[model samples]
Target: WNYQFLTQLGYPSNYYAAGEMTVSQHLEVSGQPDPYNPGWVGLDYIFGSGMRGGSSGGPHIANLGEIVDSATDPGQFPDRNTIFAVTSWGYGLGNSSGTEIKIQGASPLSGVANANNFVDLFNAACRRSRAHFGTWTCDLLVP
Candidate 1:
């Protein structure tokens, strides 16, 4: 799974403040015949706003956190039917110090048959959030 903030021109945004932060977490399954197995491998990654910006750069871009399950049923082979679940959040410069901005999502299997499926889901979420905030453009680069 992936998370991104697109600029008004469909690029990325650069917005940051002191003590501001963003994070992402997720689970994924890899190297498995059946992508729905519960024994799949898991992974997690975290990104936070530092003295400057996050790891991506000032005005953090995309922060990607995901879990991968590489364990297969042993008898099954690899296929494009892999399933993945992911969640992410973003932080922008706020008026108050220590204030935070975040976004998150969870799905049983996401039911995404392919990469495009996942992309569509995430893009929709971003657009929705942007509309609520009244922000036209933003930058998104996963770290």
Candidate 2:
């Protein structure tokens, strides 16, 4: 959605603000990253936007590029790339340039099946929430 803005010089077309996708990679975290997981949790990392406070659930999307990046509807969900993760937290504030986003898959459950199981835990949480209304369920606590 590019639009021409009126300028002081009356040119009205000097600047353009087109939105595009950025690239990043996934890596393992070492330090005491998340407070919820005080122990070793095998958390992963990736360079992200300068996301500040109250931006926890934003998606970290990667455009697959060209052939796979074509947008059928120009702008829509699942258009050109996949969301590998979401904005978790900023690593203790300084400059946001070195900030790395933590993916949601890694956990301290310590098992082959525990990794990349947010969907399961989330679904379980939902089910637990539903069942709790009827006194037949428990909390799905993800570790």
Clash number for every model? 24, 0
Q: Give per-residue CA lDDT, model 2, range 18-42, as digits (tens).
A: 1223223333233234455665543
lDDT of 1 by residue, 3-86 (tens): 323111011233344333434222322233322347653232222322222323312222223436576653332332222332
Off by over 4 Å in 2: 1-41, 64-80, 92-143
Top TM-score model: 2
**Against the true structure, whose lDDT is highest?**
2
TM-score of each: 0.22, 0.31
The Cα RMSD of model 1 versus the native structure comes to 15.8
The TM-score that candidate 2 achieves is: 0.31
